[model samples]
Target chain A: MQSMSSSLNALWNHLSDSPLLYLTLTLIAYQIGLFLYQKSGKKPLVNPVLIAIVLLVAVLLITGTPYDRYFQGAHFLHFLLGPATVALAIPLYRQFEKVRKSALAIAISLLTGSAVSAVSSVLIAWALGGSEQSFLSLAPKSVTTPVSMGITEALGGVPSLTAVLVIITGILGASLGPTVLNIVRVKSWAARGLAIGTAAHGLGTARKLQVNEEAGAFSGLAMGLNALATAILLPIVWYWIF
Target chain B: MLFYLTIILLCQLFGEALVTFFALPVPGPVIGMALMFVGLLIKGSVPDGLSVVGESLLSHMSLLFIPAGVGIMVNAELIQREFVPISVSLVISTLLCIAVTGLLMSWLTRNKSIGGYKE
Candidate 1:
């Protein structure tokens, strides 16, 4: 026991000196958690992201480490989000010929979709006595992270909270999407991609790719275009409403 | 998967360095993503080795998001107070996003002029 304590003390001192060590370890730990999550089969509650979060939280608790420290290293992974978002353009570009052909219809649908999302939420929340910021966060929930975070900040909601909602929304959409699609008897690749991306955002787009290339491509288009649309529209609506 | 992860990590480091030097408002992951995307675009096709890594990473993208999601607890007070707007926005936006995307795609493909043709 005494020797273990000394070893732990040495390790702690090492991590404190080179904080990136903790970040690297945290990522490794997350990957391992993911491996275990998959190995455990398709239980909804045992979702890998959920598992990884729980594991990391426990690690933070035991090690007495601060979130800022973890974020210092983990932020690297977060950084990949931007390019990954743009990389979405690849699949989208692959489908450009088709997308270009359908430009008008796509534009109208996105416009309507954006408005409905923003307006209905505010109206409903006002009915329920929800605050303006609550309405603000919900307003950009369907868009990608960076845009949504910006909208949240602009509308006087918590950006971090928006981030959480975005993740949850993405997970729920990805996991439940296909099942629901089948139930609704929705057919066609465009329908699949549109539904996945609109409902799920980036993660949903990733999920759509798993089923087929066309679906993935369309999903990417939906996510990106919607991101562009909402980024432009959300603030305007916020100004109009406030 | 390991190689892809390493590359992702390297991008993260690069993103941080660049952001620090330039003081950009952009996040690191976003920068890393941009670098990787450029590399992939220039390459045109994902290399066989990296393809495997990307597939693995993308397959379980949810796991990568979990830690951040749980970070919600940090702002529990704000969320509790702002729950109405946030929740409403999510549901409404999701519904809108789906409806718009669907309508647009349908309209675009109405004549079957898009990429894939109807059989």
Candidate 2:
């Protein structure tokens, strides 16, 4: 019995170190999330990122696995975030000429949108007695994942917390943003796309892409522009204000 | 394909170098994105391979967020403590931002008559 137990322990250790188990698990969870998202007819509520997180978290908790160890195997996926962010330039370039017609309007509108979302979120969180750190994370929620995390880090907040909040904000914006725009009587796919993209980033762009090509294009432009603007401006503004 | 990917990675590496050397607050990738955008502009068009690889990577961009999303488990306690404030702020602010942004875009572009947005 002791010898068998020792071999079992060795087997578990080797499996854990290999990275294949958790890596496969992570991909599988995302696939499950994607399958459900498509089955639900691309409903925003069935956000694949959210589902994957929940599934992975449950798995980690059940298996008594530490996050560090799991990340050891899963960081392969994480490493792609930087390259994917760099690739965002392609779509932004594709839409450059289209954005030129109303360049000033789009710039001013997106800048205003970014400020409102960031300031409002921080103020609301603070008013509700949230800790300084959480509110700092909330301030960058309107931006994309990598940039938002960087902003949060600069502001001395939790980067990981900011990432989760960013994703959640994306889901909320994609699902309800159109309704909000509709109630406000905002027409024109360009306006719709810009607003959703400014507030929600890439996921919102994805939704816009599916619903209307024009909206998706504008949304894609908005996301790239907003990411650059907020990443560069927010920290400057934060320090100037504080 | 390999050549395009190497360029992308080189851009990212250079971005990180700038951030470190200058202590820039913005993320390295954002700068890298800007660099790549400028390069594209100078060239006046995207290469077929670059566009293909970039689009392919981006098509499943949501998949990329999964690992970091799972990091939430590590912050479960912080989340519980901040849950109410976080949720309320996210819900109210996202909708409000969308409305405000859309209205602003429409109002500002109302007179332009470009793209038939004359509302």
Candidate 3:
């Protein structure tokens, strides 16, 4: 009995020491989140991303695990974001014909939307007594994660802080965007998708995808275009202004 | 699956090379996406394997972001300090952006029957 208990302790320690433990935990937690999200009628309010983060944070805190350690395992999932981003071209490709017909409209709206998203956030942060670092970081808050992080780093912002802001921005956009569109009488899926993607990036795109494929395709297009535009324009505009 | 993964990775590899070579400020993945888009345009259609793989990735797209989102804990102090500004700007600007974009897009395309939406 004593030997069996010791062996059990040894097994536990061995498993805990492996990076795969955290990775498996993360995937399991996400599955639970996804299940909860579906059970809750897949409402935006019960976002799987938000739930998973909360659960993981709670677990990490309870177990006294460092964020860096958790990240060591989680980074594997993070690395896939690049290829997933590249994969977005598929939906955009499928929607090219629709995009071509309204190219001018899409361009005009995207330009205006991107400008408003960056400018309003920066202005608000400045008004609220945020520091210079905050201004730089908040400027790219609306772009998707990887692109936003890159832009924030280039613009002399805190990329880590920007990552947080970007996720919050995405969650906010996903939750509130549709209601705002409804209030404004914006009924078309294309317009709705464009607004969500431009404002919320990938999270918003994911939300739009749940609604319909057409909306998803447009959201993907908006996300890609917004990433490119923000990447090019933010730096030029920042240098010119500040 | 292996073939599709290779194609995706190859595009990303090429994109990283291009960015490094040009010293571009853009993220390699964004450039990779653009390259892939252009490739599709030239090909005139998305390949079945590529779309299958792409769709699979995209279907779970939200899952990929959780790790980065969890980084919020690391910046808990910064967030606490700038809580007001961060929260307020995120909420207000996000709303304004959505309203402006949706309204403008709807208005601009109101006269046109485009993308199956008769607006």
Best by TM-score: 3
- Evaluated at residue B113, the lDDT of candidate 2 is 51
DockQ of each: 0.31, 0.58, 0.66
Window of ten residues with lowest summed lDDT in model 2 chain A: A208-217
Candidate 1, residues B1-119, lDDT tens digits: the string is 66766775677678668867986545455455556656775777666666565555555454455546657656668778767655665654565556545655565566673344221
Badly placed stretches (over 4 Å) of model 3 are A1-13, B114-119
The fraction of reference A/B contacts recovered in model 1 reads 0.41
* CAPRI quality level assigned to candidate 3 from its DockQ score: medium
Number of the candidate with higher DockQ, 1 or 2: 2
Quantify all predictions' global Cα lDDT against the true fold: 0.65, 0.84, 0.86
DockQ winner? 3
**Residue A195 of candidate 1: its Cα lDDT?**
68
- Give the lDDT of residue A7 in candidate 1: 100
Choose 1 or 2, whichever is better by TM-score: 2
Return whichever of 2 and 3 wins on DockQ: 3
- In model 2, the clashing pairs are none
Clashes per model (N, Cα, C within 3 A): 19, 0, 0
